[model samples]
Every structure is written in C-alpha cells, then in structure tokens.
Target: MTVWYPQIDTSKCSGCGECVIACPNHALAVVSARAVMVIPQQCSYCGVCEVICPTSAIELPFLICFASSDNNKDQVS
Candidate 1:
C-alpha cells in the first residue's frame, strides 16, 4: 500500500517552521534548518502544511479514491 504523507522539498524549504506549526497532528518538525516528517503515521493527509508553506515545499501525495455503490468500498481510479 502506498502511504500518504507530506513531502518536504528541502531545496525549496526556507526553514520557516510554518508548516510544523500549522500541522494539527504534529507530524512535521524542523531539524537542522529543514522541515522533516517526524511522524508519518500521525499524518492525517490534511493540506494545512502544504497550504501554509510559503515556498510551496510541502506536498501531500494522497491517492484520489472514490467509493463504489455496489460494494460501498473505496476504489482507486
């Protein structure tokens, strides 16, 4: 299974810690002047970090899925 989490582009990151502070799940942290995903499992796939990033460094690569009425189960398209 593909895990969904925030991806921080170190090159674009400004070490502003905005994403870290904005994360409601406390999943991101600034380490050595770069933002890192400290707890991937805690991430809720919310776009707060990505939206809060000033440099557009953080990205959440979540798979877009839909539920099928027949099975009432999530289906990845």
Candidate 2:
C-alpha cells in the first residue's frame, strides 16, 4: 500500500499556522509551537499545505516509478 502525505519540516516551520489553516482536509495542526501531522489518514495529498507554507516547511514527497521495457515483457508472458 502506498500512503501519500505532507512532510512538515519542524526546523523551518514558523508556527504561523498558515498550512494548518490552508489545509482543506484539516490534516495538520500546531503542536508545541510546531506544525505536526494530526489526521494523516484524512490528508488528500493535494499539495495545498506545501504551497501555502510561507517558510517552506511543508513538503509532499512523491514516489516516482519508471517502467522498463524488459520488465513489461516479463509481465506480459
């Protein structure tokens, strides 16, 4: 199973609550004066939080998979 969520960089976070407020899914929150992922399961991976962070604290890591021709041939067999 693949899970997609925003990664909050606590060091860069300004605790401005921008990301938390901008989040449509309400997945992030301010905890201990830092941004934390609260409801990870509710996150829609829409990248809104990453874009709204003024301090560049939020990041959405994506897993890119490339398909090789050889691998495709093996699967077809």
Candidate 3:
C-alpha cells in the first residue's frame, strides 16, 4: 500500500534543503514553490525529517506496531 505524507509549509520554510539533502532515500525534492516530500513510500518513520525541519513543520504520529512474527498485520498503540 502507498501512503502520501503531508505537505510542507513554504511560507515558514527558508528553503534550507536540509530535508531534501538529508533524506536517506532521496524522497524529497524542491519545487518552484518550496521543498516538498516527493516520495513518501521510502519513509522509514525514523522521524529524521521531523527533527531536521527548522520551521517546526513536521509532525509525529503514534503508529500502532505489531510483532514481527504476528503475520496477522494487527497493531495497537
């Protein structure tokens, strides 16, 4: 399944490109408007983008994780 992440606020952003350059999977890109997360499928949920965002635009989610061997794909958080 593919999930799309939220958009960044260009008004608050300073065009630092920190997220675009620091992305481990190269999923981010800078458009003519501002920086945007182009590919969210590569996100590892490591919160790297949230931590590096200077404008405090990134948000954290409480993910429900399941056991590695559960196989049922069930999760609760």
TM-score of 2: 0.83
Residues 1-77 of candidate 2 have per-residue lDDT tens digits of: 68988888899998999988998999889999999999999999999999989999899999877655885765432
Clashes of 2: 0
Backbone N/Cα/C clashes per model: 0, 0, 0
lDDT of each: 0.88, 0.89, 0.70
lDDT of 3 by residue, 1-77 (tens): 43546456778777778877777888778787467877778777666777798887666555454565555547533
lDDT by residue (tens digit), candidate 1, 1-77: 87777789999999999999999999889999999999988998889999989999988776766656766455544
Q: Give the distance in Å from residue 45's predicted Cα in candidate 2 to where it truly belongs.
A: 0.4
| Model 2 residue 77 CA deviation in Å | 14
The 10-residue segment of model 2 with minimum total lDDT is 68-77
Order the candidates by TM-score, highest first.
2, 1, 3
Clashing pairs in 2: none
TM-score of each: 0.80, 0.83, 0.63
Candidate 3, residue 32: the lDDT equals 79
